[model samples]
Target: MKLWGGLSVLGLVYAALAFGIDQTFKWWMLHVFDIEARQPVALLPVFDLVLAWNKGVSYGWLSGDASQDLLIAMSLAIAAGLWIWLAKATHPMTAAAIGLIIGGALGNALDRAVYGAVADFFSFHIGSFSWYIFNLADVAIVAGVGLLVYESFTEGRAR
Candidate 1:
């Protein structure tokens, strides 16, 4: 497949999956589980699945306000720009990174557009300390960023 086509496909797949998974969990959380009911499905002693809703971006910044529309616009702008770049990426890894970032941004953008807040539920904790509740989209963004950094460094080394 062509680079842009591949990236577009990947982005679409991730976006769909992210949307489906996030919405399902949110639906269950709102309907099935009370916000405070912690049913710890411990992946490890230090890591457990607890539901949380975040109003803002990853780690919960700028969550609540009238600025949700603005946030959605900015996210869409960024994702659209990245989609354009994905069309131009010569390397597979580069395309993949762009795909992931585009998908992730689109996922959150949808949330902001529809709900005025991103739904974040997935908390990892270690005793008194814990990470912010986040969703699959956030994971994709972070992974994409790591891949982009790796690609950049490798490309630099090659040149």
Candidate 2:
């Protein structure tokens, strides 16, 4: 419950590591590997790495003709809200979840600022069905949200 405690520091560390790893992978994919010019690289039987620029939100909705400035503003606002939540987090899991959300939001926001869109590279398919392409940041966000949901369901029972 104390500020600057172990949980708080862990949250900060998680945020920094998430952001750093995501950015580094993006840089490697775009600059070092030039993934845009190559075909999808198969990493697994049903997974591949390919470059995709998403100009809008999840699943590419509300992206066409959208303003980059507006998107960036929204992302920043979300990150700020998550940061506030992180500051007041009572549980370590909650703090970690907030950190993941903040890191992912800022990562995508950075993409919007620099490339006018978010760069998605991972692709997954199962026979005929395919999932949307996404990046590490998206993965972190989803995992964080999942943890939060789990916590929500279990918090009251802990008493």
Using TM-score, give the best candidate's number. 2
lDDT of candidate 1 over 23-72, digit per residue (tens): 66666765677544665556787776665555666556676777687778
CA shift of 32, model 2, Å: 0.9
Candidate 2 C-alpha lDDT tens digits along 1-159: 333544677678778877888899999999999998885999998999999999998888869546778989988988877776777788999988878877887888899989989999999999999899999999888988998999999997897
Top of the candidates by lDDT? 2
Off by over 4 Å in 1: 1-43
- Hey, what RMSD does candidate 2 come out at? 2.3
Backbone clash count, each prediction separately: 2, 0
Minimal lDDT window, size 10, model 2? 1-10
